[model samples]
Target chain A: DAGITQSPRHKVTETGTPVTLRCHQTENHRYMYWYRQDPGHGLRLIHYSYGVKDTDKGEVSDGYSVSRSKTEDFLLTLESATSSQTSVYFCAISEAGENQPQHFGDGTRLSIL
Target chain B: AQSVAQPEDQVNVAEGNPLTVKCTYSVSGNPYLFWYVQYPNRGLQFLLKYITGDNLVKGSYGFEAEFNKSQTSFHLKKPSALVSDSALYFCAVRRPRGNQFYFGTGTSLTVIP
Candidate 1:
């Protein structure tokens, strides 16, 4: 409940379709991240942004893109969805950098058929 | 590359019994460790963290963790378990000078009544 909100709590789309997940935060934190959670895989970082227009890839960044035009909003886009990309995506924010604990949003459950 | 491991897939304990969730980590320099709990259909809630100083760190919800450098372990523990404590627990390690966090596969804790 860290003042974070994620749009489209649940979404279902077909393969090859494009999907975008939004993360909005009111806390004005310095860092925001996108992660995906899957069975037997836990949570894996997909992308992160330290500031507006500053982004970086993570371990599992393939087939996904992200944008942060403003501090309060971070968007994760799946250019072409696939069955293997179905998972629960979470957004997190922290006041400080990696030293501090992150607060998470409720998450978006996305399914690709 | 920093990583964390939660060896157990699930742990069962009777209510009022002591509970422990194991976590191990590998990092280059000093490690920043964290623990979180996730209820069904909810976001992760922060439990405790090991930054520096004392080997033992206390956190929300009557939870605590001991950071043992020799063992490279930061295990979440509670003196007595409760039915409400039944949930999925995740352990994570934060990379230095970055916002990347690596999470474990998660351990399901079931506190029997």
Candidate 2:
């Protein structure tokens, strides 16, 4: 509903396989973020990109990586999928302002076996 | 280090009755507090935030939260509950001077009709 779309709404993968998720926004916001939601963990930031080719790791960035090639496209990759990494992933974007709040995409449900 | 706490795992109320969800935060300096709601299989939606304004902050869906700096709390409130209001609620906090925020485990609200 935030003019954001996430690809592969549901994904099933095997352990050790590689997976990539894409987040595209129509708003062309400057800040984009990747977050994972798990039971009892709420939402934890995995990575954030403030501009094209400018990315930073978040609290739970281990084993996960992200790339922002352009303003509207932010990609997340799992080099080696693990069952423990199975969770819901959300993409958020915000205007280029210090006090601007975030707008979220619908999210992707990933399951690794 | 910054953190948010949602002590109650769940909150229940009847329709037409007042409802509240408790939230407490700990951070250095003036902290930015936020509330978000998550519907099943959807992304988290921004409800409201306490930046630097009056103690009480109002948001969408007739929801409001009171920020108490003395208690380090920002509890969300509603004058009347509705069945549609039942969902997972989260409290988040961040320092205005920083880029990241810490989220609570979340509280599930159930409004009985």
- What docking tier does model 2 reach? medium
- Candidate 2 chain A: 10-residue stretch with minimal lDDT: A94-103
* Tens-digit lDDT track of model 1 for B1-113: 67789999999999999999999998878878999999999889888888899999999889999999999999999999999999999999886785688899999999999
Fnat for each model: 0.93, 0.56
User: How accurate locally, in lDDT, is each candidate?
Assistant: 0.93, 0.91
TM-score of chain B of each: 0.97, 0.98
DockQ of each: 0.87, 0.70
TM-score of chain B of 2: 0.98
Q: Give TM-scores for every candidate, taking all chains together and pairing residue i with residue i.
A: 0.98, 0.97
Worst 10 residues of 1 chain A by lDDT: A93-102
Task: Tell me the lDDT of model 1 at A108.
Answer: 98
Give me the displacement of residue A103 in model 2, in angstroms: 1.2
Model 1 alpha-carbon miss at residue A108, Å? 0.6
